[model samples]
Target: MRNETYMWKILAKTEPEKTLYEHTLDVLTVLKEMMKIFPDVPKLINEPNFWDYVFYALFLHDFGKSAKGFQESLRLGKRWGYRHEIISAGFVACLEYESEIKKLIALGIASHHKEIDELKSKYSTHRKNSPGYERYTKALREIEENFGELVEMMKLIPDLSEEFIGKKLTNFKIPNSLDELLDVFSFAVKSYEDSKSSGIDRVVWLKHVFMRGFVLGCDYLASSGNLEIPLLKNEISEIIRFEKFTDVQLKMQSEDMKNKDIILVAPTGYGKTEASLFWVEKNQNDRRTKRVFYILPYTASINDMFKRFVRYFGEDLVGMKHHRAGYFIYQSFRDREYTPDEAKKFANAFVDLSKKIYKQFKIITHFQLLREIFGLPGFEMGISEMAGGIVILDEVHSYDARVIGLLIEALKILKYEFGARISVMSATFPKFLCEVFKRELEIETFITAEEEVLRKISRHKINLINDSILNGVDRIKKFLEDGKRVLVVCNTVKKAQEIYNVLKEFARGESKLIHSRFALIDRERIEKSLKNESVQILVGTQAIEVSLDIDFDVLFTDVAPIDRLVQRFGRVNRRGRLNYADVFIFTGYLDDDLKIYDKELLDRTISELLKVQRINEVDILNLIESVYADGFTQKQSKIFNETRESFLRLRKEIYPMLSNKIADEDLHRLIGSIEIVPSCYENDYLKMRESGNYFEVVKFFMSLAYPQFFKLHRNGQIYQHSHTLFCLAGYDKELGLLVDEFETNILE
Candidate 1:
């Protein structure tokens, strides 16, 4: 007999040599902390005996690991013949409790390690002659013996006394026969199936997902041995108070936007972010608006917004979710004074917690929300959390037609099905696009900057150059020579790099190149360098179009779409202090122009630019409406219809039938991008991998458009170095990836 007076002996170990009891305690602590931070957890509190049900699930989540077979497997470093979750589920079923509570506990335990499909297949037809029946029976006998020991151990631990586990369990008996054990397991599985299929009992659905997610979150946090809770300080007002509001912002605050979706059309400097935050604040006290998601199109924009929101909401309450979110969290942690080990531990914990719990203000790209819409694994909880929240979609006009259609479908679901409120804002929202939303949404409040306000912000004088983009080099040199900041925007990465190479020689001060091809860390450094006084000339691609707050004295850009050109011009003379900044638009080469933009739209945009002498916020909006007045072309219409149909089908046909396994590749393809690490960073990548600094290593990777990457990869220009790293032979340090050199007919 084991010593009942001594500490409980080990049953299993999450980490090598770590005791199962220690792991259990860690999980319990994490569960408590999560309940404090996660907004959705509070909804469950109103349920009768909810806390008791939660405690029961957490207490017995790992009971099956106490089985002798499992313990032996852990000691010998071998795989157990049967899953411990099944044995754990059987134990929960045997407990004497209300049938509903017992079923919830059993489902939580059973589905913790595997999905419903895997669970069903494991115990189906549990006959003696079945392939896995012998192993299953042997595991059940071992679990029965371990169950007795667990009860004895619980009696010794003060926290697991009869009061917490319930007095009804004092005479609890393990199923005496295998047939009885199978029956209990079958009932638990059927209960879960019924709950999922019923679909009408939202309360039951929420409880089911919350219990499963809570258990898994606790288990993961405990196994990692990082128990620190990253919390946001309650300082929403401190961040918002420092800035003086403009007229647009004041109007936004004075208006009543609670419970209504909004369409805000304002210039870049009109405090759109502030107005959106103000709207959120107005609805903050409402029970429906529990969280806010600030959605942007680009990763850079998301990162920038995350930092800005952190300043307002504090680091603890604001979180970022993107592919490089881990890298940003690591950077935030590194900014503080911590020893190497301490930094690693805190950064890991921060990343883990932010991903698992939805913060009060979450800055994310559309991909994160799309994951929920696609019904991906582990995202059911995310979808549940998003219900009754506010989602702010910035740069609404930037996405292509297919993406626009998909977003429209997603918005329909979010508004009609999930009860989420949406606010769509952009500097150059077209009339046609506005019509789409107005027709789809039930009630939308449209707000635009007054003409007087736009006139006061008018800041740029336009010039058209019929020559090649290189012809603008002389103007760039002249601006730099005169001690004025100059910005050059190109339509393609190769053109931007070429222009940068030539202008760097004539530049009087700092000259930097920025584009999408550079690694995330390098791009971040470039963005920071833009604010340096010594940086006189900045050359970039469309990346300079939005989110970046850099202001310059002059602009030189290649001709493209009208909205894109307006965004580029906004980067110069942004504050309206220069009276009139020079914006020189040069036409790209014929092949290059068609490759980068729609030929008809490019023609119309150029025609409209010729008509305007001075470019202002109102002029930009007019030009956008003129270009899109005819709506999408026949081909574009086909693509949009197909995309919309596909998404609607997924929502109606596939979503309900989906199990835990989501087709991630299909979603990535729909998004038209993929993340890869260039071969040049192999040495640093290996060093980081060996040092276990994965989050930091992600900063050195870049996102590539799928069509470009696929074309290159098929031609043998791209190589897979490992699961996470890919090598592109054409990647250049200064020029970035040469995507245009080899490509198909795909257009962005």
Candidate 2:
């Protein structure tokens, strides 16, 4: 017979040899902390006994690791072919709870590691008289031998109810065959499907959602060594009390703004960041907010805000998520002088922690949150984490029409379904667009900088140049020689590279080029280099519009829509520290420029530019209104409505227990981007991957648009190995991706 404490000897983690009992304790510790932060989690499903279910699920989640085959695999450091969760879930049948409660607990435990379909696919063949029945029976017998010891160990948990501990856990029937064990899984799935179809079972559905989401949250947090969720420090309020608020910011923080949706229209330099924080401070003080998400459009802006927030609020209170968030976190750690090994360790850990539910504040790209509505894997946790939270959407006008439509629908669900408060901010928000948001979000407060304040700020004098911006190299060089920092914006990456190559020839001071194609590691270096006052000439595409915060003496750019052009203009003499900066618009362009921006919009932009010699801050709204007067084109409007309608249907199809594989595929497809390694880094990528240096492997990846990816792939320019794609496309340290086939082919 096995010893009384034999169950405690089962290993949950191998590297450190932590026993099952110890791991359960760690997870329960996290549960206690999370309950303090979110006491209403039980009330979310109208089930007062929800906490008890969570405890039962966590206790039985890993007992199947005691199977002889699983133990040998762990000891030998070999792959375990079968999932332990399947057998662990069989323990639910031994509980004396009601049938419905037992099904909920079983589903939560079984699906914690794998989604519903995946769990079924892996074990469907293991029924009675099946190929794997004998093996399944053997594992069950092993678990039965240790069941008594497991219950003895459970008696140690102080959080477990006294009645539960006193019950005869052995009296409940143990599965004598594979068919009986499979019944538990079958019942759970049947109940889940029934709940999805019945309107009356909506509460049942929500109960399962919190059950699965919180179970996964606590399990992952504990397994990763983060045994507690960090509490939100009252840091935002302290900053608001100490820092002086600008006129626009003061309006955003007014007492009436509490418990209301907000629309804030402010110019670029009007302290929108501070205003949003103050709004958050007011909301935090007024209600019980779970978490706060500050959403941005571009990764550059997200990274900048992540660093700024970490500085203001301690690093422990702030976290970030994006495609290359791991790289940014790794870089931030290295900046603090951590050794490469240490940085890599902490970066990997924090990446897991940030994506989970530990941090109080999350700075993320819109795509990160959009994945939740799309019902991607682990989306239940995403929804649970943001329930009763505050969502701050900055630069609301930056996304395309399709994304704008998605946001409207997602925000509706977040507000009415999940109880999240939203605050939208934009520099160039038009009245028509504001009306759309106001109707959808039910915005209560409309805050804008006073016209007098805008009139007092004069930053740029717009000038129209007859020749192409490419022909203005001489003018740019002269500015560099005169100790003036020059900014050059182009419509296409090819154009930017061409102009940068020309400028580097005769320019006197440091010059740099930025676009969308460089690897994140190299891009960070280029952006950091821009901080030097000596970098005289900076050239880029539309990427420069919102990606950087710097003042230039002059600007030369191709014609674009007036709103985008205004964003570009904001980069020059940004603070009005200089009397006025000159912005020269080039009239000449090739046919390729039309492919980037709409010809109609470009024409309207030129027509508007012809009328104004200087862009005054106060009159900028009128200029934007004139250009976007028609709102989205008919075709763009169709795309928006179609995307919005289809996404709403998709949301309805998603339930708590099952994971939609199509939804995951749709997310990647909609993102329209893929990460790839340039051929130059193939050797380094392989070496790092082999050495288990995943952080180093991540550094070599750069995002490429799907169009470019498909084009290169069809031409035999890309290949995949070990789940990573390697591209033969050429890359330059200063010029970014070399898209010319001639150049890329030469590298091949």
Candidate 3:
């Protein structure tokens, strides 16, 4: 017989060999630390015994690991046949709490590892004489044998009364059968599913979501070592210095608009970021901590904003997220002469903390926040983090129709359900999009720069060209020869490359090409190169529309949608330093332009631009309204409506205690892009992979859209190198990927 006074030992993690009891204590400690940071968590839940439910869930979460099979698997380094969360959830029945409270705790424990629906689907069919039942019965016996020691640990919970603990422990019985355990687990599942109903109390949904989200958050943080989740500080006004507030900035800081969602229409140089920060400052206070998410649509923009925020708030308080965040982190650390492994470790740590609840201000790509609504991995924690947060959406006009539809649905939930304060600001926001937000998000505030202020900046004179932009190579040469800084924008990467090739020979200054297809290292180099005064003639595709701060003397470009055209035009004479600059829009384009943009939208954009030769800063809004007057075309409307409906339906299906695995594939498909190594880097990539230097391997990758990926795959120009895809496409530092050269490439 085992000593009754003995403490039963169970493993929570190996390699470092942490015990189950130690892990439990760690998780509870993290919960306490988190509560200290986010003290209003209870108030947000606004439910009685919220802490009690969460505390119980944390302590009992790993109890099932004490089972015999689980212990053996941990000791032998083999996979456990059954999930520990299942048996751990069974303990909820033993606690002498109200049925609803017990179910809430059970739900938190059961769904912490897998979704409640996953558990139900896997074990709901188990009955007498089944293998699953036998497994449960065997595990119960092991737990019952060590029940005394488990009860002794229960006394360690500081919140529970001694008398209550004694009474609960004395009366506790090993579950009579597997049905007792199944019934308790089923109750939790039913409770969660019921909370998803249309008529359920909003508070009930809040409780269920917080319960599930907080447990996982605590568990992950506990396992990740001691990391404090910081709160937004009331110090932005001191850090960001300005000579005087612009009219738009003052309006944003005004008390009258303090509690309302806003649409701020300000031109590129109108201090919109500062205005948004002013708005964030108004919403932030000492009473309660709210997160501030500065969301952008592009990776380059996010990186730029992350650095800017860091300077204002300090590096400890600001975090950024994007697909290439790890790469960016690695680059930053490497610049400090850190070792490869050190940089990699720091990058991993930074990314992990950024994704979790450690930061006060998160500068992120919109997809990072929007992906959570699709129920991507760890979304519960994301939702919990976003509750009562301030979201600043810059460049609201940048996204396509489907993305717009998704953003609308996400805003609805974040506003109504999660209580997020969303501020949508853009230089080129259209009237139709504004109305959409007003109706869907119930926004009441529309702030714009004073008309006089906007009118003072007359920047671009529109030059309509009725021929392919590439056909006017001699005209581009003339601009370069005339000693002017020229910018050429195209609708596609191929077009950019074609124009770059023809003009580089006659270039008067440093000529460079930039697009999305370049590898990370080259892309960053080109982006930085734009800041140099010598880079006078720059050619690019849609990637050049925003996030770049360079000012060019003239712009020659394809005619796109009005919003995009405005963005391109803003790049030239960006600071109003020039009295007037020319933005040449090609009405006729090579076949590729039609494939890149809608024909109908292009026609409307051309019509509006032809009506006025000079595009005044104040008249940009009118230009956008004229082009987008009818809103999305029929095809665009269908895609928008279908995406919105699908996501809203998916939102309903995303109840507490469900698996993210269900939506993982759908999210991946939605991105419809991948990263691959260019043939030029194949040797270097293989060396890194062979030597286990994955941190450096990522730098050689270039992102390829699905269409380009398919074309390369069909031509047998790509091959799988381990898990990394290698493409035989030609690449150059100045011109980027050369798709036309692929026909001559042979893999040696």
Worst 10 residues of 3 by lDDT: 161-170
Query: What's model 3's TM-score?
Result: 0.90
Per-residue accuracy of model 1 over 1-748 as CA lDDT, tens digit each: 2232656665658445665566666676766665544443444434655545656667667777877878888888777777877766766655668777677777777777776567667664345567566556677777654555566554433344233333233434444443455333556666556554554254565566667766766676667665655543343334577457776676567647766788988988778899887776665643322668888998778878888887676776677777777767677667876665676787767666666543567888888888877877766556655656678889986888888888888787677656677888888888888888788875468888888767766788989889878777876788888889889998877788888999999888888899888877777788888878688989998888887888899999889888888889888888878879999988655676676677888888888888988866777788899988988756677888999988875654222212743477678789887777766676678788889878778876888888768776777657655567464545556667666453221121
> Candidate 2's C-alpha lDDT?
0.78
Better of 1 and 3 by TM-score: 3
Quote each prediction's TM-score. Answer: 0.84, 0.90, 0.90
lDDT of 2 by residue, 1-748 (tens): 1123443667788776878877877777777666666666666667776877877888788978877677778789786677788788877776668888888998999889878777776565335767455555666666655555566665554434332222223324444443455444456765565666663355676677788888899898888888856665554656556456689777766777778889888899788988888888777733333688999999889988998888787788888988778877777788899998899889988888788888889998888888887778888887778867889999876787778888888888778667788989999987778888899989968888888878887889988888888898888788777778888999899999999998877667788999888876678789889888778888988888896987888899988888888999988898888889999899787788886677887888788878887667777888888887887767667988898888877767777768775554467667667888877777778888998877667778888877888888888888888888887777887887786642344333
- By summed lDDT, the worst window of 10 consecutive residues in model 2 runs over 162-171
Superposed by TM-score, candidate 1 places the C-alpha of residue 672 at a distance from the truth, in angstroms, of 1.4
What C-alpha lDDT, on a 0 to 100 scale, does residue 64 get in candidate 2?
A: 82
Q: Model 1: clashing residue pairs? A: 231-316, 232-316, 232-317
Model 2 CA RMSD to the hidden true structure, in angstroms? 4.0
Q: Candidate 2 regions off by >4 Å?
A: 1-11, 66-82, 94-98, 125-127, 132-134, 153-182, 190-205, 240-243, 285-289, 471-483, 663-666, 743-748
Count backbone clashes in candidate 2: 0
**Whole-model Cα lDDT of every candidate shown, in order:** 0.71, 0.78, 0.78
Error of 1 at 547 (Å): 3.2
